[model samples]
Target: MALRESPESPTPRRPVSPAPVELASPAPTRHGTAALVSAAAGVLLAVLWSFEFVDSVIGDTVANNLLGHDAKATAIGGTGAGLLFAFVSGFAGTFTACNIAMVASVGPLSQAGASNRLRHHLRSLLRPVGWLALGMVAVSATYGAVGVLIGDGLPQLSTDTVGGMPVRLIQSSVVFGVIGLVLALLGLSALGLVPDVFARRPVARVVLIGALIGGFLIGRPYPLFNKLFHWAVETGNPVYGAAAFTLQSLGNIVIVTLLFVVVVLVTRGGFLRWMTDPARSALVTGTLLVALGVFTVVYWDLRVPSIFGVGWFPTMPYN
Candidate 1:
């Protein structure tokens, strides 16, 4: 045993294995790109629509007042100064109660699930958003057609009297009053102050409510579109009238869509969670609607001049 120590003896060594290689974590999937794109498109359309609406308002006013009811004047003036006004109005509309309510209602639905993939989320959202857009377009176009008809018939009926009131004046007042009432009721319902009749069928009721509200928002009398429709009818150019309202509707669609996108982004699913509380939704929506309704009434009934204003409101021709 003592003789085993030798210079050539190698020390025993344990086998060393290579260190385990760590593969990079799988790349995270991007989500919500499509929704973002859609929102951008909606913003663009809204701007365009708002611009056109402003143009119609200013152009009609100038043409009817300054240029002696000339269609040529309207086209020129509206296309010129209208662009500036439209931008202002469009920007202003973003902060309105009706618009805010619409955003609150639709924003939650625009969200895709918690999936990390962008495409998957987009696929989920596309159908609902597309259907909403399509519905808006259909309703808007119908409003346009109605405007055209109203414009065409106004001139013939302007001189006609109903119960000692000008047919036009009567028509304007009644329409305005009725719409204001409807808006107020809608607001009340949203606040949960009204009965639960509309709550029974939430989906259909919401869509129908949106359509009615949208119709009033886009095609209200005393606005430029109404005047433009009249001018178009006088000139036998119904296309102009139709285009104006349709474009405005498109603008509304864009605004709503963009709002939905913003809310979804900001809340990050919290809005969806919150929206599940119907009572809360109703309260918020009702408050906004009430404000809008009151504003509508004041603007149309109180501010609008009874005799000198153009459009559906009865007015003496400016000499």
Candidate 2:
């Protein structure tokens, strides 16, 4: 009897842990490294977007003192163009960096998980990466185009002699906000992060709230999008006005960052998991896309004069 009781089926040997996934163990492909670096830069810009108070004050000062009044609005228009340039360029860089990072992280893991055919696994990754890259480019380009439209609209808005620094700052902010979103989306896709379902609703609400706050700070009438343009008319020093606009621009950056962070964190478990899980991930991605589109449309048409008012922050020498 004692002999019969001996083995106890050896506890049915616990299943062995799955083999570790192989990342891109070989030297990173040029494309993959580029993606990683670009994503890092994108992250940095996202952080810069968070500080509203300081930027606004500086903007106000620049608008009032540098560009002076009437020409201020035109300068703001130009600033928006500047931002569009910065954003699109940055977005391109980030996408490349992120793609590299994904290969470095996932390629190796896949190899470790299954040693058979490494090249095949990596080749499969290319499609998703391409899709992500294309998305990034499209979104950023759209944002820049919208900025152009808004910049063109500046002259008709108001006859005030305020600074252009404020206007420029505002235009820059709008471009940055939209461009930031594109970068964020690409980063998420490259990292194989979650799609964003769990946090989509909350993140969307936050974006909306942030937009409202930015509008209020600038003295735009609440509610209707067009009503907010009047805030471009400043009451105090040109610097103060520019500073206000800068701060308002910063507010938008902050909102985008918050949403980006939420998506990144949720997907941190694994980019593939997020991508594969349509229900959760798709919802998040879809919401972000929708939010971005709406913001672009509304913000672009809101007011052309306020951007020129940014001139109050930076006075024009020729004037």
Task: Please list the residue runs of candidate 1 whose C-alpha ends up more than 4 Å from where it truly belongs after superposition.
Answer: 1-136, 146-151, 155-170, 217-219, 230-244, 302-319
lDDT of 1 by residue, 1-319 (tens): 4788578999788999999999754321111232234334333332223323444555344434543444333453443343333323333344332233344335223322223334443444454455554555566566555655675465323557655545655555555556655655665555445564556544544455456545544424433434444444554444554555455554545566666656655766455456556555555455444544544454345434333343243222321
Candidate 2 residue-wise lDDT, 1-319, digit = tens: 3555456566557789999998873323533444445544433333333122222343334333433442224333433433332222222222121111112212212112222223444443433333323333333333223333453255323233435434433543464345435434533443334353324333332233333323322222111111112223312133323433433333324323334334434544244344444343333333333333333223332323333442222212321
Regions more than 4 Å wrong, model 2: 1-121, 132-269, 303-319
Where does candidate 1 have its weakest 10-residue lDDT segment? 26-35
Error of 2 at 311 (Å): 18
TM-score on alpha carbons, each prediction:
0.52, 0.25
Candidate achieving the largest lDDT:
1
lDDT of each: 0.46, 0.33
lDDT of model 2, residue 173: 49
lDDT of 1: 0.46
